[model samples]
Target: MTVAYVAVAVLLSIALVGSGIAKLTRADQVVTSLTGIGVPLGLFPFLATCEFAGAAGLLVGIWWPPLGIAAAIGVVLYFVGAVGAHLRKRDFGGLSAPVVLLLVSAAALVLRLLSR
Candidate 1:
């Protein structure tokens, strides 16, 4: 079970870190996508920063369970907002990725809690 938890955490970290880096480095693309979804372009960096923080927390949590749990919870909340944003914009087409990430983050949180 610990192995499984670590695996999920690592994978989720990869996905999130990759996304964060893209948001930080690829302003034009991120801005366009956010605008299409009715999100403010200015929010991109903030979101990216959250992602980076969550990713770091997850990685650090491997040694400290509480941090990982907190990171997982934060990620879940982040994705909830993401889903809400997409829904508000009626951008169903953009729902899948965030939805999947939400599920993954939720799973990680659950697993972490159970492990503790």
Candidate 2:
């Protein structure tokens, strides 16, 4: 279970960091998707900060269960909001990524809890 948790945490951290970098760089697709969803471009930095923080927490959490648990919770909420945004805009076409990330976040949360 610990091994599983570690693997999931690492995978999630990589995903989050990659996403943060894209947001920070204002990748064309990210900009388009975010603006399409009505998210302000100015908020990109802040959003990236959240992703970076979450990734850091998840990585550090491998040694500290509580931090890892809190990070997982934060990440779950982040993706939940993302999912809601897509749904609110009725943008079903762009919903897959958020939904998949939400599921992955949930899995990380559950695994972290069980591992602890």
Identify the leading candidate in terms of lDDT: 2
Q: Where is model 2 more than 4 Å wrong at Cα?
A: none
How well is each residue in 8-59 modelled by candidate 1, as lDDT tens digits?
Answer: 8999999998898878777676666678987766777898999999988888
RMSD of each: 1.3, 0.5
Give lDDT: candidate 1, residue 40: 68
lDDT of 2 by residue, 25-102 (tens): 999999999899999999999999999999999899999999999999999999999999999999898899889888
Candidate 1, after superposition: displacement of residue 8 in Å? 0.6
**lDDT, residue 48, candidate 2:** 95
